[model samples]
Target: MTKSLEGRVALITGASRGLGREIAQRLAQDGASVALLDRKAHWAEDLVAEIESTGGKAVALGSDVSDRKALTAAFESAVSALGRLDIVVNNAMWTKYAAIEDIDEESLDRMLGVGVAGIIWGTQAAAAAMRQQGGGSIVNIASVSARLGLPQAMVYCGIKAAVEGMTRSAAIELAPAGIRVNAVAPSTVATEGVRAMLDEATFEARVASTPLGRLGATSDIAEAVLFFADPMRSGFVTGQSLLVDGGISVALR
Candidate 1:
């Protein structure tokens, strides 16, 4: 019996935790040999072990996404280890919240460095591998902040918007090579980091705004990514951003 991703290899940045972790696990379960890239090497290693224990194939790569050379090398190493790269997910990002007036240079630079530059480098490296392998899919983890005005998150908003724009441009350029580029924009998800950051009131308000009346689960976003990552599911989809926000993007605020 052939699996959905049988014989395919996938590389996912930020695979140590949260949505990235789930995405990596999902891909592996679907039968892809997953390369888990994360700055926290130990975490990725642990996840890789867990996946392997479940009869899935996975490898951990500790590489800083912000470093173009390191990221490029990591992509190559993934290919060498996994055999070939067919799916790439640019999910690593850095963010620091500050009001527009309080925004600082360092924070902005770091956010853009990882969110923007990292995606660019990842796309470049993956395109090179995928073009050689015949074709591939790339999924950028964007955010609803890119489409909505969020106070104290201007930098994050801008960075995500940039990612969405890049997704479209890359799709157009890579289409000729049979490479597909797309993005998944998720709203506030109930991850450990988010739960720690949002107080009760704020959290409830966010959930209330969503038609689903609940925060997104890691699996929700992971399923959306799987859709984009599989050619059989999204063969004709490209240059588009799917909002996995449970109708929040449409609810009148």
Candidate 2:
């Protein structure tokens, strides 16, 4: 069978580590040329080198996704090097867990800016390039927090909910242009970011709540992203948010 994404060019934000890195690696393994973008450019550089060592084509670039100018430049650089753009994975986010009283203005703003505004910038930039190329796909990484509403994660939930809303609206508007926008909402993925915030006991407790009795892995989320990015696999799908949670969202107290 032919690889679904052969000759496709994918630009994945937050490709330095965690779910983003896994997603980039998976797409490259499937024969897509990848542009790995992250604020930690050096991290992406190392990852890109690893991908290249494995016989995949990739490049690393640094850009603050919330900065429209920087994002635009990054997109141009990727196109210049890769020849064209076909997919965008908006996986960058700034997350801080805190109670309402403990949350400060700066932290809240940063979360919204990086998590929400970043998606907007990436989508707009990718949409423009894709429209020019005749079509494309966008996959936004959201969270089950947006639906289940965890304690001390109010700001993070807000940002994710906003992302879901944007995905729907963009899908509706961009459908006519052959651009598909959708989101994946994962629950408690075992990423470096998540590990930093969750202790062994806390992680176990959370996992136990899920019917699957396990936390999600980066590959779990990556597979969901791959499904959305392949037009042939999901050609009829748009304006949807696929929840990658292990039945946690449906759990009853």
Candidate 3:
């Protein structure tokens, strides 16, 4: 009765809330020991407890993913605590919505720092740890905003587009080292952050625009991530981006 990721160790950034939290729990349920890394370490402790209650191994770490040194240290700590590293999900991000003309330099820097630089550092750290283990998988959480222009989300869109490009380039570079890189792009998922950002009318409009006729659930994105994280499910898949937006990306509507 061995699970697909029975002996795997995974690290997920932004694991304190929303989609990040869901992904952590799902991976744990599949028997992968998880390290939940967030800006505030204590924010993830409750999730750690929940996973442990289900007989899963979990740990929480605090670090600014934008800082290379801090991120590398967190990765090292994750491996030290979990015994090894086999998977990583680059899911942490910070964003602010403003008109293109109103975009501030500080907010832009923070968004790029978290959304772009964070992925790079996470990839570097995960690859180093996985190199020793022979091979591993890394999944970056992207957004459909990368492909479609959304008002007040210019910076966020740019970051996600960069993520996809990096995923491809990193896959090619790391593939030789036995590490696979990929990304999952989700659209209008009903996460706490998404809910907080959108008004009722906006939320309904998002649903109406999707062919699926409903907003995506956190589990939906988590399952997409699991497909990439589990070697048995996606061993030969790399350098690809799966859009888990319930048909929103392709719908004519």
Candidate 4:
């Protein structure tokens, strides 16, 4: 309501639903016009419509974040429509739970393509636009899996770890250009995607392991993202991975 982000423009990937959607909504509520990007064009359209219905300005773009050309076009279109790009949230990811031995080449390729390469390409494209605007913030969505390795999430863990590394390195490179890069790592968020994969027993076990004795919600992660995107709040922060995992990372092994 205070409109801290008034006149700012934001682009969010995988914003059709889940954490990405929550992040987009929160940013829009803070008065930033948003571009919702997703592989599912219809989902993007619906999200944009919802936001606009609520008196928020938004545009929907369909593009694969991992595809350089497509992502470039989407980023350019968003900036062209919104007038400038102030924030970019790289939240798209292809994740699956499988044992290391069960993971085949195809699965691995898809995971890395969306998880790792998507972040790399999105960050670079957003940074270029931000540079032109004199500066901006890039928020990469990572996972607690990177810190607390799960048995069936080996590839996902590896991809998130790579994202953290990239965030740090890109922050350093982009600092001189006035662009800030950071990441948010959440654990076992109760999104539809996670709920579908985890049973109540497993979910409870996870919560018990967390120091907070609870699982994370989409809003929990979105709040951290909002903080990082706010120049006034996190202007001095960059190249850092903020964990929004209900203290799961601190649980004793």
Residue 181 in model 3: shift from native, Å? 0.4
- For every model shown, the clashing-pair count is 0, 0, 0, 0
TM-score of every candidate relative to the true structure: 0.98, 0.98, 0.99, 0.97
Tens digits of lDDT, candidate 1, 172-249: 999999999999999998999899999999999998899998999999999999999999999999999999999998
Error of 4 at 161 (Å): 0.4
Q: lDDT of all the models against the reference?
A: 0.93, 0.92, 0.94, 0.91
Clashing pairs in 1: none
**Candidate closer to the true structure by lDDT (higher is better), 2 or 3:** 3
Q: Highest TM-score, which number?
A: 3
Per-residue CA lDDT of candidate 3, range 41-108, in tens?
A: 99999999999998999999999999999999999999999899999999999989899999999999
Off by over 4 Å in 4: none
- Decoy 1 TM-score against native: 0.98
Model 1, residue 116: displacement in angstroms? 0.4
Candidates 1 and 3 compared: the better one by TM-score is 3
Q: After superposition, how far is residue 160 of candidate 2 from its true place, in Å?
A: 0.5
For residues 121-142, could you state the per-residue lDDT of candidate 4 as single tens digits?
8988898899997999999999
Sliding window of 10 residues with minimal summed lDDT for model 1: 39-48
lDDT of 4 at 51: 86
Give the range where candidate 2 is weakest over 10 consecutive residues by summed lDDT. Answer: 39-48
